[model samples]
Target: MSRRAAGVILLAISAFLTGVKYITASIYSTSSPNSGYGADSFKQWLDYVEGNLTTYSMIVLIAGIIYLILAEIDDFDKK
Candidate 1:
């Protein structure tokens, strides 16, 4: 695929991952207040999400940025 296409795909994936992260964070915040769970459990869940999903989101975001830069460079090269 072309650099522009790859960049677009990476950006789309990053956006989706970001949306998921926001939804998960909102769910955790809204539910934590009403739940009878202990603080430790909440902390553990937060840690787990941060370690896994959040990490993937960050990686995807970085990759998207890289792809975008490459696309820009490719455009420049063609000029």
Candidate 2:
């Protein structure tokens, strides 16, 4: 696949993951006791979700930057 296509797909995946994280957090917050205060399970869940989100977001950002650079190079080559 092209850089642009890969970038778009990465962005879409990142967005979807973010949305899912938000929903999960919301649900946990509402159902848990005072937003998982003093709870080991809640802390673990939060940590897991946060780690995944951060990893995916970083991947998306890096892919997007690479895509932009590739596009710029293509443009320069044409000029």
Alpha-carbon runs more than 4 Å astray in model 2: 33-48
> After superposing candidate 1, which stretches have Cα over 4 Å from the reference?
28-48
User: TM-score for all predictions?
Assistant: 0.63, 0.61
Error of 1 at 32 (Å): 6.8
lDDT of 1 by residue, 1-79 (tens): 9767787887788788867765675568557766546666655556646656667777877887888898898889989
The candidate scoring highest on lDDT is: 1
The candidate maximizing TM-score is 1
Model 2, range 6-78, lDDT digits (tens) per residue? 7677777778877777667656756866445456765566665686777787788778778867877887898
List clashing residue pairs in candidate 1: none
- Model 1, residue 2: C-alpha shift (Å): 1.6
lDDT of each: 0.72, 0.71
